[model samples]
Target: ELKVEQNPLFLSMQEGKNYTIYCNYSTTSDRLYWYRQDPGKSLESLFVLLSNGAVKQEGRLMASLDTKARLSTLHITAAVHDLSATYFCAVDINNTDKLIFGTGTRLQVFP
Candidate 1:
């Protein structure tokens, strides 16, 4: 079966604090994508990991993939209130033009 899972579904982070979000998959895949969303807003693409050890970063967020272990991670550095949002990781299983997303991680950054 193909599945994706994210731990710590809800997160409350303090300003200047750092944290990492973990994502695990149950099947082989060719690509993975990371995205961010604000309340009532559409998702914004953050990273795309296409191969083993692939990584992408933007600002305070970094995302990586390890295809061998079917794992991916998103790390946040020095979080800020402005970074409060929900993050999602999706996997393109079967390379069939479809993406199955893991349960989202909602983060609240406070001062």
Candidate 2:
């Protein structure tokens, strides 16, 4: 099986709302990362989780990694039209740079 899974392949959220996306992995990994991509643009780094219980946040987005459970979460707060984008989580197996990415979560922030 592939290494990663993300829930809610698509999400439509209203402005001023909150949501959380979950990412689950099948194997042990050394690092987990979250990225966001605007329409027609490359992904921009959101968070990099290096160890168990590592958590990071920026603006309205927060990400956490639990190595022991092989899980990661990206929480979105106060949705806005500007936040409409696709989110992806990736895992670096055994500390290698080659990351296996989740299918992705497409979020639409309704105005």
Candidate 3:
């Protein structure tokens, strides 16, 4: 069975501060998987990892993965209220279409 775990399930930080969210998976996965969701909103793709050591950044958010370690990280720099949302990482099961998502990390950014 494939499983994904996210660290710091809940985070509350002041605006301008920085933080990181981690995702660890139990097995090898074939593609990219990062998403965000605001309250009552649909999920949004935030990052896509095509291979080990892949990294992507947009605005104040950055994401990277280490396939060898089965670990991925989403880092927030100088956070703002707009960045507050639930973040998730998912993995394909044995190169199949089946996916398993991590327990989301709900972040709250206050000014």
Candidate 4:
């Protein structure tokens, strides 16, 4: 089986609201990463979790990783129209630089 899983394939939020996304993996990995993609835009790196209990944040988004449980989370503090996009998390396996990505989380932030 592939290594990663993410819930709520789609989400919609009102402006100024908040939500959280979950990611789970099946195997041990060297790192986990979060990325965002806006319409017609390339993927933008959000967070890189290198170790257990790693957490990183930028703007209104925060990401955390727990290797013991093989899980990761992305929390959105407040929703905005500009934040409407797709979010993805990936796992970096031990033998390869390639990442196994979640199906994707499509978010719509209504203004």
RMSD of 2: 1.0
lDDT of 2 by residue, 1-111 (tens): 557999989999999999999999999985999999998999999899999999998999999998888999999899889988999999998776889999999999898
Worst 10 residues of 1 by lDDT: 93-102
Q: Candidate 4 on 1-111: residue-level lDDT in tens?
A: 666889889999899999999999999985999999998999999899999999998899999999999999999987888889999999988848889999889999898
Flag the better candidate by TM-score, 1 or 2: 1
lDDT per residue as tens, model 3, 36-92: 999999999888787889999999999999988999999999999999999999887
Q: Return the clash pairs for model 3, or none.
A: none
In model 1, which regions exceed 4 Å deviation?
none
Local distance difference test, candidate 3: 0.90
Residue pairs in collision within model 2: none
Off by over 4 Å in 3: none
Sort the candidates on TM-score, descending order: 1, 2, 3, 4
lDDT of candidate 1 vs native? 0.92
What TM-score against the true fold does each predicted structure earn?
0.96, 0.95, 0.95, 0.94
| lDDT of candidates 1 onward, in order | 0.92, 0.92, 0.90, 0.91
CA error at residue 104 for candidate 3, angstroms: 0.3
> On a 0 to 100 scale, what is the lDDT of residue 68 in model 4?
92
Backbone clash total for model 2 is 0
Q: What is the lDDT, from 0 to 100, of the residue 71 in candidate 4?
A: 92
Q: Looking at candidate 1, what is the lDDT of residue 22?
A: 93
